[model samples]
Target: MPTQHKNIVLLIADDLGKYMGSYGCPSISTPNLDRLADSGTRFDMAFASTASCSGSRSTIYTGLHTHENGQYGLNWARSHFQTFQYVDSAPKLFNQAGYRSGIIGKVHVGTEEVYCWQVREESGTRDVAWVADRCEAFFQQATVDDKPFFLTVGYIDPHRDISTRGGFGNQERQYGTRVPLLDVKPEDVEIPRWLTDLPETRQELVEYYKAINRTDTGVGLVYEALERQGLLDSTLVMFTSDNGPPFVNSKTTLYDAGIHLPLIVRQPGAKAGIVNPNMISFVDILPTLLDWASIPLDARSSDKDSRLPTSPPRQGRSFLPILQRTDLLPESDWQHHVFGSHTFHEMQNYWPTRILRTRRYKYHRNVAWRLDFPFAGDLYASITFEGIRNVEPPVMMGQRKLKDYIFRPPEELYDLDADPDEVSNLAGEEACESLLLNCRERVTEWQKQTKDLWLYRDGQSVTMLGRYAKDGLQVPERLDFDVENPGTKGVEMTKHLGVDAYSAGIER
Candidate 1:
């Protein structure tokens, strides 16, 4: 039988940010990833919807935010937050299209029924070579059956090891007798702008780089496997990470370093070796895959009888059209803005943040501004944090003060064009008031659309209130109360349905 659709091989790296040779980081060695980027379209502005492990992966699988999907925190260590049973996942979608969907290594997303992979090989070791070997076997089997496979190879590389001993677990003998070709020296480590350059940081970075190099080698092996099985041209190969590195100011935070991922997609018959700068979210991944497989969007949802009323529909559109474009589109021609939400990383790290990022501005609405921000388990025990805490008089992490990082304002706005590092807060500035308000409104509208639970302030959920009947009055089309000052009037909506009326009167 002739192949009807292209196969999908998604290689996901754990805790890896955009710090590779293809992304213009010279110190790190990622030859396989660079080659893949050269043979595909490298997305410069791809971002994860959430920064935590299970939350980010859940977004990729279900095309819904953490708030809607219910995988709000880590999946292991007694923090077993599983996705809602009614939610449709990626493997289930691909399976419906008659493809054998399988996953190898690092299954953090959730329950067996929700993920439903046809072939599941969960690995605890961080050995990329071993993972590549297993993937090769899977590719060979798929070749035998002539099945269009949707294989997701999750590499546990580049993430911190099980201990605070600063090892990335790249031991060669643990996987096999194979030796790693790429090795990074401590002195050659290029420190990220958000991290302080110290001996411990450099040393740990070396291990991280080694793990990344191992992952790259694994990628090369998988590519070769596909080639050997005559599936290279018929495969849509995508390589990306779950979130940013395991470090302070990156992993669990909604900062650019945390959510900004490295995405390279080599579509079956599209133009290759192009750098696409379009802003895409992780939520778009499932839809894009469905589109590529010629599956209907409605195919992902549950049957009409079993659908949950509170479960919001998928909020992402496919970017497959952008991939087919021969000429580069302008920034305005693509998605102008992307939204992000992070409710928790670990069970205790409950700092719910919502962000709306445009080309020039970023607005972060911290829901729990009064509480001290908690840290992830790995980040708190990291050697980098040790170095930062050892300094006298308490030095700040990156450009943020210790207290400021813990106790943040309710809102934060940054001009990305002027302050790319997000060091300046323009939320309170008089000149940026209108822009801030507009961004805030956009975020609030998005929250309402997604039915976010964090849209509440001061023990009152404006979103929830807007949905119910009040004093026999029809529900307002929009909630116009100021988020910063809950009692103040911002924009008032009329009681008449379909009338876009606004009044400067406070109802409360």
Candidate 2:
């Protein structure tokens, strides 16, 4: 391997959040990941921009939000969301700098030209030992090629099977050495506050834990492989999930349960077991990787002609400066608030929403609040959801009622210190109106920067309205037009969200 540059290894799990013992949840066994947390720095305030798989992964790879990158929904099977071709990608940057870049497991982001790695082995197999074997081969190839390596290993365990009732893919299967099938009983699992603790749910959890144990073993196996190759000291390892757990109210929602994920980084020679409290979004991952590789932070990944006059620079800065800090970084040095943008999960799940979260408050803006929040195929078919819907009278989902979950208001505001689960809404209250408006403005500002087309006013997209705004088309400065009056007379019109650049479409 090249002596001047350190290797990079990114391990991402599918449909996982902070469910491990290390993240203070003892319900599931994640010993391998726990050890990684103990040996590296664990970020407690890490987040995903979008809770959907492809959208979140694209955010990590491109250092851009889903709206900015154009991966608005799922990219697999009937859904066709892909990152924009003009975007700068981490793998392409590493490849440009002469590193041996490869992705051994699942590759969710699309358009080969955007994520142009030197080697790509995209697969959906859950046999993690096979994945370890492939990683070992890639390391050896890098050694032969005499270059530092950059590899992304995506684990498919702990995610639901394509078959709706596959029970998280847990079965009487054989796993190789160091991979023990955990004996976690249904009673041993702790039902999250976001879920109902029922018999069917418990039964399904037993299988979910088994899958989690396999994923943990896979992490250990890959670490052992890197150690065997004598690259432990020369590699930068990071482990995180693409999204939260594959359950209702978690997978597709902008609530903390869905977007707040586990992020552990073990940079070479960094202090071990340090807990980092600085807030970070998934968009920062790419810049941090490039920072570690000693590449120019603003270096263009490619010079190909773009649809836009110029490709947008990454929205986030690197966390390398504070990666090893145990204390909370000051607000001036790091951002205290985190933002989330979720457009869709499956094509059918089109409840476009934006969220702004600070330490004290959380605000959610549901653009299509009238739509009875659609479900991802897996979540709708899950045993947990089935139990929630089929049970006797007084149907409720955790502390929230089932109807409340299905039908939501246009805006929701919660005091996080009082309601971490975001059950109580204050958006409609008179006293909280000031805080509500402030949060709404902040989220709208974020949408404009990302060029989000979901910014709706008067029941229409602001981006669409911008195309005709210069021609004196009025975009009423309100969520929806008043049906009783049915006129724009004396109403304020503004191009607050989509202005100037958006007037002629995103082509500019």
Candidate 3:
């Protein structure tokens, strides 16, 4: 590692929450991560743009909201899932800045864009042994070559299959782990009330803990590699997740459990023990890393190029100043609001949704079809079919049920201060007049500014007219549907959610 450029290593786990030993989750053995936390700042108020893998990762890479990045769905090939080649994705910028960049494990960035990188195929967040070895090898090579590397290592343990909940899928295999049984009973796990209380959910939480532990062990390998190469002090390490855990309303919703993620950044030669509570978005990552590495903004920089022509809004400010001095920027100075949306696993044809979050208030705009069409089928079984022959195709087909789950009318809202779970809808509450008004205004402004169909205020007319016209009745200048790739129909469905909502006059 060279002293001129700070080495960057980002470790991201799938579907992790603040349920780690470092964050005061007792019984979970996350020693390696705990050690990292003990030596760096653990952010308590960081958030992902969306809880789903693709949405969150896209937001992190583009330094833009999921809506802005055009990745509201699980798959790519739609206009919304378009890769941010011209934006502030860390890998793109880092590679252009003369740094060797690579990724290991699961990457939600679109397949089209990822072909340029050296990537590993294993997906999920769990105790995969091979991931650690590959990561260590990458670190060693980077060190040997004296390169300031931007390497992203993803872990898929503690996710689905190998779950503790009465075993993963139908195989019923209990996953072994080092974590102890805490006071956390299965009933104590806070999640959507719609899900049934079962042994599976309980064991699933334990499996998640085990997966976290394994991820930490992998982290330790990289840390040891850095130490062996005598580059510990020259590297800046970051640990976080794609989204919230994969239980209940956590992973796919706009509630705190879904979007609020953990972020820990350890810089070289800096204070060892510190905590910064500044509210930051995943989009701010690129600018922060670039600033840390002292990389100047050139023509290739998203910030630099966008300034020349029309500039869409960049939803987050750089964290560099806050990193230098925790008090330099107040939490409010960092953001007025955060936005999120989800259209993945579109049961009833890709449930489209948009959300807004302030410090204490949160609002959701559901632009999907009605929610009562049908409950999704048994797609959860795929987690257990791992390593089985002929399972891949069936698993993939079963996932389509996730896309068939019914959706409901185009609008919803919640005040997180009073309803952290976002269970109650305040969209029609007269008492919340002021909050609703402000939220609607903000969302409309953002939609118009971002050229989304969600700018429409009439939910009824748009839906009726869209249905009548047979070509989505789009709100003028709002989000429109465009199929960028022919094979992926899901992308088109997700992209049309906002347009349909706007056309339906769903806005408050």
Best by lDDT: 2
Flag regions of model 1 displaced more than 4 Å: 1-4, 171-181, 301-311, 324-333, 464-468, 471-508
lDDT of 2 by residue, 369-484 (tens): 98999988888888788888998867877777888889999999999899988899999899999999899988887877766788778887786567666687877788865688
Candidates arranged by TM-score, highest first: 2, 1, 3
Candidate 1, poorest ten consecutive residues by summed lDDT: 499-508
lDDT, model 2, position 103? 94
Model 2 CA deviation exceeding 4 Å by range? 1-4, 164-166, 306-309, 495-508
Clashes of 1: 0
Could you tell me which residue pairs clash in candidate 2?
none
Check candidate 1 and list the clashing pairs: none
Cα misplacement distance, residue 482 of candidate 3 (Å):
26
lDDT of 1 by residue, 423-491 (tens): 788988999899887987888778767767667534445544553434343433333334575542343
Per-residue CA lDDT of model 3 for 129-208, tens digit only, reads 45666777877777667777888887764455532322322233333443222233454443233333344545555445
Model 1 alpha-carbon miss at residue 41, Å: 0.2
Which scores better on lDDT, 2 or 3?
A: 2
Better of 1 and 3 by lDDT: 1
All candidates' lDDT scores? 0.80, 0.85, 0.60
Candidate 1 lDDT score at position 29:
83
| Candidate 3 lDDT trough over 10 residues, lowest sum | 395-404
